[model samples]
Target: MNDIVDLFVIGGGVNGTGIARDAAGRGLGVTLAELGDLAQATSSASSKLIHGGLRYLEFYEFRLVRESLQEREKLLAAMPHIAWPMRFVLPHHSGLRPDWMLRSGLFLYDRLGGRGLPGTKRINLRSHPAGALLKPSFRTGFEYSDAWVDDARLVVLNARDAEMRGATILTRAKVVSTTRHAAHWDVEVERDGRIHTHRARKLVNAAGPWAGKLSETTGDPHRLRLVRGSHIVLPRLPGHDQPYILQGGDGRIVFVIPYEDDFTLVGTTEAEHHGSASEAVCSPEEKAYLVDFVNDYFAHPISTDDIVWTYSGVRPLIESEGSARSASRDYQLAYDDDGAPLLTVLGGKLTTFRKLAESALERLGYGGQWTARAPLPGGTFDRRQGVAMIGRWMEAHPFLTEAWARRLLRSYGTEAETILGNAATAEDLGQDFGATLSEAEVRFLMRHEYARTAEDVVWRRTKLGLRLDAGQVAALDAFMAEARGEAAAAE
Candidate 1:
């Protein structure tokens, strides 16, 4: 391991990876260490929508809205395969809010974002197909723009880009201690039961929910509010590819987004969490609450039995004086009095990760004004025109299965060809799992995406765990164990 680095970032969530990518692009020597798999925390458990936070307008968060809006469009074009556009239908319950007010909100959302995604459109609930699943009491609604992101993939792609730009990304590596040595920080990274130390001119605590704890390690007095957000997945809603944003009776917004091909994701409950971020679990109460909220707004209600999976994430909110929901989602960047130059990132949303990272790098005095036009990994291709590249890759590998080819194209874009190389058939990709997962793809992820553990491979690199059975996971685990042994012997 390199003992000298320009910047050391704690946390492997969206913010940390984004900062690493941005800083690396600006020619800074960077290293990012994560105690667990990337996105194992809040990054993967997001509502998975990238928008301007239209609801934020009511709170008068104009700056957040505008920044998020711009970032949304930039990220959509930057990583089209893992992220794409989706329209959201806001169904108005006549018994609740009026259509004009909803229309006004949509108007603000449309204009606030100069995003190319089409503006708001009024819809007749009785005539629109989206209305068929809604309660009869809802007769009017509006459809507007937003984007759905494969949240985990976003982190992995960013990490990959940073590595390509010469940043060292170490997953399953914990930063257990740090000491200030005059103008720099001596950071300790623990991996494989060994402690590796490095010196960084600047350190960033972008550990999301763990930011507060990381600050304590450096002996900073700042504390953060760890709020838990939970989500539930249910059997797919018929023809529910587009997402729906509904206003809960409690005046909060709950998202019912189309999930994997056969599931609908509904979430999230916000409550003060006083637990470990890595061990956060979705409580039965949260699942029930989400199911009830969705059922109240829809004709086809989902119950506990309908649930497929549930996940919970801790939002490291900057402690303030109000309800956790009202607690500001605005991020804070700090340089404590220690002079060791630690930048602690607090309170950020998935939509603004790229911008949040850019700001973090600027604060560290590394980039100053560079990387405004930088692209993420595989982002060199015009993402909006990704289909053409997919066509070319498919044409080149005619013997490959469509499902397998599409999986690579959508997840890695044109970079999939690099993995495919001269392979001409399924045999070229090696052993196949029940899903499109293959030995070739797994090796590529392990070599390029910092996938060191089964969780990283199964959960982050691919969502195959949701589709694979327990037995399949066991097999993958055994395979990983053997691979780890071989890797250790080689070293």
Candidate 2:
């Protein structure tokens, strides 16, 4: 049995953690439960972007676009470590959207959010660096500004901040059942082969694709349409630092972004997903579709064989009459106060998560909105200081490599020193499990970041999974398990 909390969050994704962080910061007791590792599902498998959906303008989603654009700068400022600005080049295809339409859309996008980022401009592809990599047919293009993010890290940071603000975070804790009463709700959470009971004054369903199924238990009539968005990673396409937004004839768009320095990330295909959301994988068709889509734009065509990695996430969108690509990225907060207040988050995107959290709290009648101005964990410094911070790290620790220092800065920002701590040489960081993943860093992640498994460390906490091989991953997993066992035995 546990003390009755003010809010019980069911899920550990972006939305759930965001709500927990917001509520906890406002002096509300919060407990968040996740069935798996934090960001093990949809949250970690995103296209890794924090941008207003440029294509949403085509569907006349003015409100969604406006909200997302407004949030873009705020989010970037909040977490400069994990989120930073990126320039996107959209090649003007004669057969697709016309020049005037693109210009008009870009114009609206630039002004919609008060123009914090650089505005759009027309560029001659033949003379531009990005154009050198593109097909000759793309003589001209439009460049606009957006941002990139480490999607999984964003969720973990929110959870970390929430925990710091007095919220209880339970990873691998499954909410087995929930019983609502007139004043509170009784929730049963199963973890470590045992079931724990908790009581809360309010319940939140931020389970992403699983929200629909969880709604049945709360007796809420809301449903969600599961749409799978998949992405493929290929070896880095040279000659361009800016990412390209390739327009497709099928009214879809694919992003070819530089990823992890040595690789390129191209995605994502929108397809209606069925069955279990957890089982969603990048299918052969999705891979082929992405390959074919990029081939149309790149001067050097790539086959599916060039794909080094693929990931898929099932997005729980609002049930509407349209194709999955045309579905709304806008979120709806369904507040059911028949008994205990139940707030169900329906649909949302990465860019507007903070706004969504504000809305969720507002629905629950909690006021003091503070996340917009506050920085997340490890993000207390100015956004523009990232590069200087990394340089300082290298200057202070002359033994550290530029790549290692840069990775640490990007992952931990000002807190990287906490891990580096008094180490005069790289050997002081202890065992290296390949890909610059030192034991010191691993311990920090496990102790502070709620990282239990290597999957959580490599894939979610940092993208070292792209660099580590199978044997190295296995070794890392073994090391983590052994470390956990030793800690448990000691306890």
Candidate 3:
């Protein structure tokens, strides 16, 4: 729209925003544009683990598992508010893999990439609290440590950090076209029905499932394996906070995680996606597959009727010769600088987005690995400080419920203070949208987090959608629409 920037990133997913944040922090001008809300796709649909892909070891993805393991510790340390350690229980299935194999794999997992988490140990399920929930036949199991993260929040924070570092962040903006030039590239982006043209010395295509399509804009044809992964959320199991990793007859593994505060998150089936990513959904067959698998292990049985919600996302995996289940989650960068500089990110995972960004920038001829240690926006405190911050907020604002305070702290971290402001009581929050969603928090998300819709706030920014009633959601939607209209009129 104005001066030529150093880098123009297409796609506001984890990789695009991460590269923009990295490039901007290194004194390079950066601009990022997304067609929709950040992390509205695969980034938010993950199984929500920051593990080393323990199952990846069987496929001999040692390198990926190692890198992921290393990132787990870094991310856990960097953002303790939205991320924390979770213990996973893997029950032994002699019918699938042998006990010796499981033990050996666990050993390698514990030693790989400087394990900061607890080592694996065998347990008697019958005696363990988690075991009581399982069938009596499942007598033995193993427990190990991994972390859970708010995947959508991770993308948003990166974008926020990038904007603070002088990158132009545009949501609901689509890259209409791009043309190569001698020293730069001209890009046209459509936002609010207006076409804005800009110039950049370098262009990056990190469009997730749309990367291949974006590459076509540059006259390069690239294909990726679009694997649809789907997850189902059930009403929370009565006891235990720990999650389970169950093996299937087909050799694939499914995770049954503790989701939100009152739900069990189970998934996912990896089937080849035939259509656009936007149309991906949990097929009826996949639903039956998951239900049957879980029923095979747990004492309490559930059918599709028990599922409260389901989500699906298409992963743009590097095309490889194998079943979609065995496809590589590793990413590749295709750099073409024949006349104008262009770098297209082929495939990537949520855990390795930072390293992928650094590599992308280095290929674009940028300097330094500054993002490795830098904290994300609102992530300046250590784990102890995070707990203390929550305690202090609860102390100062005695009107706030413990559950509300904890949720806000985990979602916004220290920025919750800004949203709380000088409000002495709950009424100052303006309007109560139910499920602890106050108007103050909604405005905070709108003002800073690029949340333009109630779905953006309820589903992605916060999982409060699961708790809100239908009428509450409709009211929130109406409120957001009015607020957006008012803001547009003012502008």
Candidate closest to the true structure, highest lDDT: 2
lDDT of 1 by residue, 1-491 (tens): 45778899998999999899888888889999998888889999889888788778877888988888888888777777778888889998766667788888778777879857899999988999899889898888899989988899989888888888899999889887898877888888899899999899888888898888777878775799989999988878887867889887676789998776767889889988987887888898888888889988899777988887888899988889978777778898987636778788888899888888888776776546544445556667776566677677778877766666667767787778778888778678887766777778877887788776667777778777778888877777777778778888999
Q: Could you arrange the candidates by TM-score from highest to lowest?
A: 2, 3, 1
Model 3 lowest lDDT segment of ten:
382-391
Worst 10 residues of 2 by lDDT: 383-392
Inter-residue clash pairs, candidate 1: none
Every candidate's lDDT: 0.82, 0.92, 0.90
Q: Estimate each model's TM-score.
A: 0.96, 0.99, 0.98
Q: Model 3 scores what on Cα lDDT?
A: 0.90
Ranking by lDDT: 2, 3, 1
lDDT of 3 by residue, 26-47 (tens): 9999999999999988888898
The TM-score of predicted model 1 comes to 0.96
Greater TM-score among 1 and 3 belongs to: 3
Decide which is better by lDDT, 2 or 3: 2
User: Candidate 3: misplaced stretches above 4 Å?
Assistant: none
Model 1 weakest lDDT span, ten residues long = 366-375
What are the per-residue Cα lDDT tens digits for candidate 2 across 12-106?
99999999999999999999999999999999988888888889999999999988988988998889888889999999999999999999998
